[model samples]
Target chain A: MKRIESLTNQWVKETKKLHKKKYRDITNQYILEGEHSVQEALENNGLIDCVITTDDGLLKYKSILSKVSEEQLVVVTDGILKQLSELPTPQEIIAIMKKSEELTGFGEKILVLDHVQDPGNVGTMIRTADAAGFDQVILSEGCVDVYQSKVQRALQGSQFHVSIVTNVALDKWIEQAKMRHILTVATALDDTAMSFKELQLTESIAIIMGNEGQGVSSDVLLHVDKKVYIPMKGQAESLNVAVAAGIVMFHF
Target chain B: MKRIESLTNQWVKETKKLHKKKYRDITNQYILEGEHSVQEALENNGLIDCVITTDDGLLKYKSILSKVSEEQLVVVTDGILKQLSELPTPQEIIAIMKKSEELTGFGEKILVLDHVQDPGNVGTMIRTADAAGFDQVILSEGCVDVYQSKVQRALQGSQFHVSIVTNVALDKWIEQAKMRHILTVATALDDTAMSFKELQLTESIAIIMGNEGQGVSSDVLLHVDKKVYIPMKGQAESLNVAVAAGIVMFHF
Candidate 1:
């Protein structure tokens, strides 16, 4: 197998750029680190451009490595792996996978995010939405780039399992969803909002989760058919955005 | 106000040591940082052993500082503040608060953790339990200290609002809960476990959440009156521990 020793090499330099959002968007590829994520990508038939592994990783992942094409496998030095990895203690294996194309048509249950910028929250919401059996997750333009490494880690390989569309116009999407006869529910701490426990699930529903500090924006609230709030019995100002999303997603 | 410039001072040394769990336990004190937590502690009538602030903090928090006794206030340099803080950008103010006495006599709804080691998860579970109107949270001996900086941050101001008992003997607590005629529910992914949706709540209940990787421990599960699993419909392995806790807490 060919080995990459020099960090100065064009391939190494390009792969290192995957750590940033701009580079990931430009190349339409993102780095998948750790054994679980790489294995998940392989199992999901992800479009893998290449696999980079340290000497330790080659032995550790010998079983999975056998499935990768000889040309697609490049063993790299620990130094090169460190330079490419986003983690403090870099994992030995990394896979370069093409971004999955966005899906069309909404599932019966949909989750929409409005300027919910934290990468961890974004990733967790996607994972929870998937587990809760939501059809699709659409993020507004102001949300963090879903391809960022922090998000990918929080997603725990569920990103590949779910349908996620980022940089969508949330207002326009909500209008379209309403046109499609989907019930739009806004989650906010407003006087007019009914308790989430009192919410009735329809055949088609789109749930909107808002920013950490701000509840759902007024424009989005205007488009929603109903507004519901999780009853807060304690002094906590608000629930963590991801936790709130999980509660709402699974309510049905 | 007395300004302490020397890090070698006995008070400074003692306060800095509170960052570690051993010192925190020995002194029965932990440093509460940032404006929100300090304010919450003040409002909640927490025992304020001392307050440390940088010049900027003293000026910024002058209104609140007026309420604290002159003897309890110590103005320190920014250097000392940095040394005392865990965040990269340290908060201007830090307060040393005495740990509250543990509560006895269980509330109607109690949440217990068994080896849920992640500080963020522990804190979030506590916050979610509070928001869901649970009466108290009991942490198993193996769980992370609730006073840890990360856990404090995750809890926001809710730490002061909730009754959290750490380092408890969970088995004994479960037995006592059963004796009190409280329904004991274990959250696990066992085949025989009923779906969480089908769970019937009792007037008084204690729900046990488990370790991130390992579900409910066998010993704890053995004592539970019922076992329930969140029904998952997607390819993701499982929901995040805190998310799972939130879903379960809100189910009632």
Candidate 2:
């Protein structure tokens, strides 16, 4: 393993920029930090570009060092890891992974998040989608970056479990789904919307969730097969987006 | 109309202590900060004890200004509100609300959160439970404070919508529920739990979720009617705690 002490190292600077979504898109790479996160990355070690960490991090995870090939290991300082991480306390190890080749139509169930701005919500949805065996999570163009550290960390390594594709035109998918007889359920607040429990079964479906402040976009809702809602006796207008996604995913 | 500018003001010093759970418990009052939160307390004026804010906060909420009795309104400086807020940009208004007296009776649908430590999770669960038309939320002895700023913010006024009793002895409630023929369903990972969607739900039920890291405590699990699991498909192993809760809640 070679030490990457030079702050001027082009790769170090480039990887650090991945902390920002703009940089991630430009470079097509994202950084995963923390021992647990790095280990999870290696556990699913199919598409990682390289593993970069401090000597101390290497020592800490030495047992799993054999997991990555020598050519893919890069040693750097803890200070460098801090510079690269979006975490308040930088993790000891960070791995650089190539965004999986954009995946589409991977399986029966897909989730479309509509302009959900919260990083934690996005992450939780991705993690839950993976756990519920959803084939893929398709995000509308304006949603939060899935590769952002907060989201990646929240995914709890589920990021690697499912295919996440973004910048989608949801209406086209909804049209296709309807043809396959998969009902597109858009959650709404109105009484006309049937209770979630009463929804008809669709083996193939796309449940669309909207933004934090607003319900699903009107355009997306218009294309859905049916409008549904989680009935509320309490005054809360709705559930958190992630929670809503979870409930819908599990039941669907 | 009086602006209490000095920290020496009796209300200012007393309000500062509301930041801690100890003081909130001892005083039997909790502070609601931010315009939206303060507005929530005001809208539910039956629960508010008093309010403190700058003139702007008072003026901004003029529509609801008459809701709080004039004496309950105590004007303060921005600095006071800042010191009272966990967030940097403290909202102009802050209110002191009396904690609702715990109600008696095991309702038709109850949610038991065991040792859920994240304020966000507790709050979001309360909101989700309310939206799913749950009867109440019971927090085990170790669950996070439901009155914390983040929880309050997450609930988005659902706190007033549902009955939440914290620090309850789980056994006592289990006994009470059993007498009422209420079933307990504990969410777990490895337990050969039936799918959450498949539960033979009794009219009266308790959906129990556990701590973020550890699933339901062994003691709690022992008492549940059945252990239930949300099916997962992707390679990821887990979903966020709140998401898991929503999944179970929606099923019933």
lDDT of each: 0.87, 0.80
| Residue lDDT tens for model 1, A1-252 | 679898899989988888888889899999888888888888888889899898999899999888889999999999999999999898898888899888867778889999998998898899999899886888898999998888888888888787888888888888889899999998988788998888887899999999998878999998799999998887788899899999988987
> What DockQ would candidate 1 receive versus the native complex?
0.79
Residues A161-251, candidate 2: write the lDDT tens digits.
Answer: 7778888777787787788777688988766688877887777777889998887998888888788887666677767888877777777
Residue lDDT tens for model 2, B1-252 = 456888787877887788889998998888776667667766674378777777787778776666777778778777777877778787777778889898877778999999999999988888889887897999989888887777887877878777888898887788778888889888986647788768876788998999998989988777777898877766777778888887778766
TM-score for each candidate, following the candidate numbering: 0.95, 0.90
Share of true Cα-Cα contacts across chains kept by each model: 0.83, 0.95
Off by over 4 Å in 2: A5-13, A104-107, A171-182, B7-10, B43-46, B171-181
Q: How close is candidate 2 at the interface, in terms of C-alpha RMSD after superposing the true interface residues?
A: 1.3
Candidate 2 local Cα displacement, residue A170, angstroms: 3.8
Please tell me which predicted candidate would have the highest lDDT against the true structure. 1
Instruction: List where candidate 1 sits over 4 angstroms from the true fold.
Output: B7-10
Question: What tier of docking accuracy does candidate 2 attain?
Answer: medium
User: Which residue pairs overlap in candidate 2's backbone?
Assistant: A131-B232, A132-B232, A132-B233, A133-B233, A133-B234
